[model samples]
Target: MKRGGAQHEESIIGASLVAATLGLSVPAMALEVTPYGAIRVATWWTSSTYYNPAGDPLHDADFTLDLQGDSYVGMRVKEGDFSALAELGAYNPKNRSAGVELRMLFGEWNFGNGKLRVGYAPSPYVYRSEMIYDADGGFNGYASLFDGRYAQIKLSMNNGFYLALMRQENVGLAGIGATNSPTTNAGNGYINTPFNMTSTTYMAGYTDFDTFMPKTVLGYEGKAGIVTYGGGVAGNYYKIRTVAGNVQTGKDEIYSYLGFAHAKIDLAPFEIKVAGHTAQNLGNLMNNAAAAAGSFYSNNPATGKNAYTYGGWGQLGYTLNNKVKMFTGVAYESNEMRGRTSDDRMAAFANLQYAVTKNFNIVPEFAFLNEMRSAAGTKQERIYATGIKWEMKF
Candidate 1:
């Protein structure tokens, strides 16, 4: 009886060992990681500086080779219903030296019919469009309202509704006609009650303001058959501080808002996209204040009030075959006030993309611009550019 019991115990131990070995061979959940990036090279030429519409004969024929603008890498990780994403790129706007740019770093939680996202990500205000291939796309193209990314917490539903609260930096009231020097432009002054034309103008330290309230955005998207559409509105508040030689003088609260809409239609071989925005005090959001003839905030010196601006863009694309495509688009923007800097701007572009392989492409593009300088007697300036890009993705 003792021998039989010992053999029974050994049999039970063997079965337990086999179960442990099988468990070791399989995992409860496997985390998947995917890496992606693009390598791009381009040779571009500009007839004039887009920033300075006042053409310089010496600098009119500008040409260079660029790689920094379009090179980037990203990764996506997924496990069960949770996922995370991160992307970085090289951006060199000021010089040839590359600067690291953080494009996205976010984690998401998926639930039935809804999602929650946190960390830095794309702004909800931007409209997704095919024209988002170049700098102008976000800066001045179809979805120029507020095209950059920001840190935020967002809640979204699968039925195309979303809400997000985001943080943004203050670029100051410099472009809004606030100055430390006395200016003859009566229509350009700070909004202080009992307006003073020469109230010791302080140049905007773009960093002088602390955001009192985070920016808020609400939007919806929908699709039907061959068409898709989306739109949203955003509001922001800031507390601006005035200083004199390191001494704090006064503080003021400012408010700004924007509204945007976009639509796309698919027609087999042809596609069309359109987007537009109306905004006030959005210089920091779109960088429109610095673009040639691009509209942005400019104060009414007499009343010290900010001006409103409106902009829009449209594009059409045709697929010639599985490997070739053609696209053309136009964009325009204007300030409500006629005689403000960057009060009027317009642009047009056309491009042809030929896929050399499944992972490589070559694109040739041409663009033209008309910029009206308010400070220069509202003179209209013309600029042109042509370029070819080669890109590969993995």
Candidate 2:
């Protein structure tokens, strides 16, 4: 019986070898798939009073409990040199309708010390802060340069060099025409100034607003011993066909540019991260709060003017032990616009994370935000918030 079993095993091995030599059917390497996610919920007692650009008080303090926008589910697939990822983010789960949307979906090909990545993913230019305020918002407008996610094609090398062409942030004009609202109709438009100066009139509307080229970014990242650092530059261009009433006016060209850098240093239980940027006509690069406060774009497209914005943030973290960690950070940003009061903002935050288990944590935090200067030179508002966030990962 033993001799017969050995003969059968030898026959199977010989058949497998023959199959390989003849390119016959054979079992292939199995694909690897991993599903992972995190659920985050928090309770916040926030107090603040909002003021308009004119310094008029608008709203009072409030308190709320909700799910953090960072809560998400993701899947990763890998097969040898190729890999893919898909993630969905859930926002405002406490609302009647939870906002569930695609956060990232991308595929990458690895070849010869570099990678080719394609599809929608977080912009490589973004270096998020450690601030956990407002569900890890990282004080986006106040200091951090978060370009958000975009559909892009990126090429990155192992040696810290990368380049990408991404969807352009289209520029638009508002508060134009006779009325305070934007006008799409063809007519003479007037631009109202915050100051007592006379209003500027122009061909009221623009037609054929388009960007001829995609936004481009070039950067490098490298690490040595206990430190990591990188910097990059980006540029974009767009044009608009101007119109004075029904008469076709000349076209206006707009250009946007940005330069940014960041550094991270780690030593044992201590770590530090710092980042900063300076830019012109950031347009859609920043969020609504940042753009509105900074007056990032020209009020009148005809002027072809762009404002300058710059800001930075830094954080220090300390690990107390295997189950506890603490962090503190500050962020500040400012902008200078022509014919308007430059706006500046600052924020400070501190938090402590306690590990409840290997896959769960409890974080208690406090944050403060101050609007030092508004575009209209008004004292905007100050916010103070204290909260506890609970998170579970799988």
Looking at candidate 1, the ten consecutive residues that score lowest on lDDT are 179-188
- Give candidate 1's error at residue 50 in angstroms: 8.5
Candidate 2 backbone collisions, by pair: 203-244
For candidate 1, list the clashing residue pairs, or say none. 171-206, 179-201, 179-202, 180-201, 180-202, 187-301, 188-301
Q: lDDT scores for all predictions?
A: 0.65, 0.73
Q: Could you report the Cα RMSD, in angstroms, for every candidate shown? A: 14.3, 13.4
| Candidate 1 lDDT, 1-394, residue by residue in tens | 3567557645644553454445444566465667688877777787864343455433367787767464777778677889888776656444333245667889999997999999998788666433323443433432255455778999999999999987653444533323332212332243362334233445433124444566788999899899999888888766655555566655556566888889889996999988888877665444433443333333335424455668888889999999999988888876654444446677788888899999998888887766645534445556677887888889
Score every model by TM-score: 0.77, 0.80
TM-score of the candidate numbered 2?
0.80
Best candidate, lDDT? 2
Clashes of 2: 1
